[model samples]
Target chain A: MSIPRWAWVPFGVALALLAVPILGLLVRAPWTRLPELLTSERALDALGLSLASCVVSTLLVLIIGTPTALVLARSTGRWTGWVRTLVTVPMVLPPVVAGLALLTTLGRRGLLGQHLSVVGIEIGFTTAAVVVAQTFVALPFLVVSLEGAIRTAGGDYERAAAHLGASPTRTFLTVTMPVLAPAVASGTALAFARALGEFGATLTFAGSLQGVTRTLPLEIYLLRETDTDLALALAVVLLAVAAVIVGLSQRLRGAHG
Target chain B: MTQRLALLVAGAALILPLAACSPAPDGPTVFAASSLSGVLPGIEPEASYSFDGSSGLVDQIAGGAPADVFASADQRTMERAVSEGLIDGEPRMFATNHLVLIVAKDNPAGVTGFDASLDGVKLVVCATEVPCGAATQRLAEANGLTLMPVSEETKVADVLGKVVSGEADAGLVYATDAAGSDAVEAIDVPGAEDDPNTYWVAVVKGAAHAEAARAYVDSLVGEWGDDLQHFGFGPPL
Candidate 1:
């Protein structure tokens, strides 16, 4: 394929900007210290906890946000816009504010917070809260992306299949869903990448603990104090993992495209 | 006329960048804790405060954030800067606060003492990284008790919130903070002093407005700095 001559300037510039940061991550990644860091039990524990929380957070967001996106995609009027705007509130609010708001509403002494103690159900300061916080911040990304895809897709395919006697659920499964799969997959990948890197809200809403609530990003932050090299090493690892998932998602999108 | 529309567009173009970059002149840009608001001068004659998390303030200092002066909730962050050579002079202990366990005022937990914060009791603590959280953890360790909290909050205020909101049965926070809450009752948590003492101060290194910054620091350390001690923050420097 022949490329346009004028496209090279901006395209090359954008590529350079993107590649420079990755190159820096490579140059300063502390490759030689990998053996020493990889051996530590605490490092393993922190990584495991981070993976567990990000997965649960992504799953919870998907379960709740998927239906919410469907409604937002189909609704009309000022009310729909307001509800859609409200759904995106977490994405706009500072993560710390979201954490504080969560605390005020769900903390031990909150309006509903007091009732939790009576049932012996505690949601703050644990692994579960880490998931909750990550989900709270990350769900909107998936919701917005999927909702946009669905709105652009329109409902005609499902409606046509239904007119031919296929059930609403069946038409959705067979016709409308296949086209939206790319958006769903990409949304999941974006949410996963975001959840993997979430720090402020997690730290604010879910306290960092070595084996308890300390996610990889939290560990990287704490490590910045006593161990700069080790912290950089963790950053490289986090970058690498997020990159691979993003790469896979792009490949999936391309195959579908 | 198209000329008026052009002038309006020109006006908006000129104002937009300046509006984006400038801080409002109304406030002091004071960075302190919510708990300290009541005890401090509350308002300077000229400037208003922009309260923020203590760790955030220290990070801002390290990152060359613009500020007149900084007042942290704990000494560790101030010391972190001192060790890193980011700040100018020594940071003194401006106030001291004991640890307290906060519960909903309704007392629905039927709780009374440190025992309520033990295992099986839902508790909220600052993540071990922050000063208050470390204090809570150290107190727990000194008492030979292990508390697996329901969640760990990044800021002390979040821990206070977990208790204030009733999400956790009890939360460990500074006594000064607990005292400020009407909906939450404070139970004296023993052995928090065994942990390192939290210090607050006014250290403005690389300040944009050095004169105003120095004045703020000066008022915080002198004999006139009695309001800090009066609020039970500890003996003022």
Candidate 2:
């Protein structure tokens, strides 16, 4: 696994590019005020909201996305391409555009939202809207990751269980799911982390209120205007959380391999 | 082959900074608040513009963003820059804007100005970090009303968008912004004139085109005053 000598230069440059920003965050962080900043009411509210919404969104992603992954992995029809493309759309679309799409689809006067509002139900600028936006953006991570894992795990064990007098659902529950569990865990972790870092779409679709829709990223952004020290401290907290999630996901991936 | 690849990478590294440092050929780079995004280009079509929330612009300028001139929607933001010595000289007041309550064209919530009809309505306003938000707060206080906004958007434009989209029953945005958009109808806020936000312009401390920056600021106060008034900005008091 010896790396080419010429590649080292470009690789070194890439590593430096990634390392410098993290180093900058570490260096510029207000270490002295971090304790007070994180303990502040604003910080706590945002932190709690971020964790709750992210958890709810991740659960929603797992419940729906796992079946979607299974179907995509098994299907061979031409429409599968379209379905996969639709699933991956949020991953490529700008976060703000994803937010706008969500807004237009579920806003008070949005496509279906206009009808919903007639029934006195509105999704826009609510905590539920925050979850919807997060789920929209985070769905692809779980679906894509689990789809690849399902494809790699293949149909052998499922076929064996089916032949041994097991029902399709029973085979999936007993054999298929266990085999893909590690991948699912990693994917869920990745999706949860993505939801945790969601800012633009949530801001656009859900709007920002202290305890309602302002997640840590949105709080950090608003604070940057009024208090850079608090912003930096919160950013350090977000960075640490993201780092831990990424590490855990990587370990899950290693376990899967 | 490897040598050629290494040389190509080295050449790219050398050229990238030069590419970034290349100035806009015809005009100075102007950083103005998001509220001015609509009219600033119309007023000074030649200058390259970076439009954002004024407080965000202040942070960027402080962080060494490549800005030649800076125009803020309020005095407080400009004063912060002045206090931090980010400006080359004292910023001059160029224009003024006051908060206007905007609603969907049909006014679904039956919002008529800032009256009791606003009670229990899904109202939005700019976050207090930006200028319009500050004025909204002042207007609310001056009139002795406690506004309960459903959301506090960082950009006034977002506030307007929410109202236009009918996600919000009403929003507080700049008078000029309301005037610029046809999607929403503006309702005058009582005593808004008393809490008007003044626009301030200044050249950055080490602007690449310092003379052009100063000229732009001069024109905003001088020739562009009429244009500002036309676009719903009040003449500087």
Candidate 3:
């Protein structure tokens, strides 16, 4: 079937808007110095911290978000809508606002934080805060994606397994989980990418300390103030990582289909 | 359906040009450092302002962001802009600021003074890239103390925020920031008085509103001294 000519105008405009900046970045990136820049001590530290924290946060999203997604998908109640909205709040909030919210609730003088400080346990400005901020921003992506998948998969298979004398836990582990593996993988990838790119919230809530909370995005931002070439190089690295993850996830989904 | 589409297109065409027009009747847009957050806006209530780290502002101006005037927290950044041909003329000194050790109003950690003993204390300071952070490093060196900070924020306001929030026991911020916040109390660092952080202001090269930009700079140089003083900034050297 031939597509309408007017539709091509808007589609082309959208494609150009998205592709221009990416093409600009590619053209301006310092390809020769990329290796040296990526291996710099500060760059390595930020990359290491970003990788470690994002991994931890992705794992956290998988564990906590999976159960939450399951509940949201299976349950039917007025309160469930509110719960789902609350879970997705961070996804919609500006990262800086999310950071401020986290700070007010978890900082030393924060409501619960002040009480916790009495026991001499502090989480602000630490690596742990980085994980918390990343998880806060990334959890919604995992929950929303997985919940949609769970709803699509439905309960017929689980019901059949239960009718066959399989326990609910066993059925979930063998039947439901296997069926949802592709969704879980795609959700995990999306959450991992989101966590890796987290900047404002981590900088505001966790504070940018080398070897602790300064992730690659923060490092790129700091470098942008001083060295554009190095910043562009680091940005290319982030873009490459994101592209790889997205390509892999698409391939996985395609294979499943 | 076509009528609605035409109306929508017409509305967007009208609004797009309006958005592209210059900033409203407020005088020329001034990109000033965050340290001038309090005084710049108050002095030039009619002028538009963008306050952020001096280096970040320099980067923005260098990348061709449109601004009539640029006010930097340190001379080095202004000089850099001048060297890069981003500034119209020689940047002039406008105001100076001194570093101070600020603790939460309650002084929970009971920080006594600027000493090496602060190594054990939880402190926050601006990252070395920012003007405040660079000044902090000079002060630390002048005093011969190796300070270990729990966090190095990108901006002085963030450092002040951490201290005010009691997340950090102490922070090194401008005296002006300390003066503005009752939530934090300033502790005088002895040698900090010697290494002052001077501010610079200049008109941007090829500014769209050159007359307004020069007038804005003149206003800052002429009668804003008292305003700066009111904001806890030191007189221009």
Candidate 4:
């Protein structure tokens, strides 16, 4: 059945709001001059860095954030409320502050950094620092989304499965996790996209060295150095990459459903 | 049903126009260096502002951004802005800044002097895209050092951040800026003599608010010159 006209208005308004940015993107796409801009060195370094960091960060989130999600999902104490809030801290923190926090905790002079300095190992302003900054921000998005799914899957599913003939780990790996597949895909995709576009923290902590720490956002920023058309061109690519992730997420979610 | 529908319709009406464009109040557009923001309120230029890298401001002006006034962190950028005819007349050099090698008060690598420097220090600088970076590069090269910076930040503040955050052993930043931060302490090297920093202000061409821009430029000459110099800039024009 069709939704009522008035009810559809908010949806329409939301679409309009979203459309404005897309329209600006299209209007300023630098379409005719696309080929020359796309192949430039800054474009390549940024695109590579963006991809590498997103991949590494998504891997880290899945590795570390999943266990945290599991713990939060299973716990129902009153502290869970506060824990839930804490999980979202990075999402709200300004990217610059997040970078500062990372550096203070892990830079060469950082609390841990001073110790690592003896070993001659430094973390900040490196490619590895880029990964750390991205993971710091994106992990929360994945964790929160995954925890919600794990909660919805509920203990009952696992408990009954355990009684029937499955181990707890087996039930989690098979029935519970398979059922939560759609959420996992969606969360990972969201986290990946966020990691890809992250700028301030990366610039602050990773130290924008071309072909080293210079991610796509930095490249786009650096693009304003010589060419706004190229900057606009980079923006177009960023939009495209984001759109692809969003599309893949939807398609995979549809399949999972 | 009617109440829900009425609320939705009213909400849509209110948000639709609001999202498109709000009414704007009038103001001149002063494009300035991001460093200027640290003390913009004191000068009270009669305009709205978009503060960013000194080079970014110069680029925007050259690219025909609708800026009425331009203030930059160093002579290189302001001079270039004037050369492009993006600025109207002789830009007055009103203030000076100095570069320092800042470290976290805790100090990591125990970096001391630049003339004894090499390409290996964990240094940070403003990218050559901005004027501070340009000044930084000049200073490093002048000291007979080849800097292998860990990062090249867009703004001088970010370079300072590298030091404060302990990301780098040292960063080249404005001494006045280092004074404002608890995260960093200045290490003066003997070679800073040749790299005296300066700031220049100019009215942009095709400014819609020429009168305001002129008044602001005039302020920089004597009275305002002293204020800038008080902030550790060199002597007034």
Q: What is the per-residue lDDT of model 4 for residues A77-171, given as tens digits with 9 covering 90 to 100?
A: 99988988998999999998998788777876678888997797877667888898999999999899889878766677788898999987898
Q: TM-score of model 3 relative to the true fold? A: 0.93
As for candidate 2, its clashing pairs are none
- Candidate 2 at residue A46, lDDT? 94
Report DockQ per prediction, comma-separated.
Answer: 0.18, 0.45, 0.36, 0.40
| Tens digits of per-residue lDDT for model 4, B46-112 | 4677898887778778876778889887787787787888988888876667787787676656666
- Report the Cα interface RMSD of each model, rounded to 1 decimal: 10.9, 4.2, 6.0, 4.3
Model 2, residue B232: C-alpha shift (Å)? 1.3
Give the per-residue lDDT digits (tens) of candidate 1, residues B122-217: 677766756676777778878777787766655677677656655566788877777677879887777765453665666566666667766666
Candidate maximizing DockQ: 2
Docking class of 3: acceptable
Write out the backbone clash pairs for model 3.
none
The residue ranges of model 1 lying beyond 4 angstroms of the native Cα positions read A1-31, A57-140, A150-165, A198-208, A221-231, B1-59, B66-76, B115-119, B141-148, B191-214, B224-226
* Model 1 C-alpha lDDT per residue in residues A1-257, reported as the tens digit of each score: 97555455455455555776789878977899987895687688888998988889899888887777878887888898888888788888887788777776776555676688569766766788788888988898889988988888867887788899998668767886787888778888888888888888777666666788888888887776456677788888898899998997787767556
Candidate 3, true inter-chain contacts retained:
0.40
**What's the distance in Å from true for residue A135, model 1?**
4.4
lDDT (Cα, tens digit) per residue for candidate 2, span A153-198 = 8788889899999998898888999999899999999999999999
Docking class of 2: acceptable
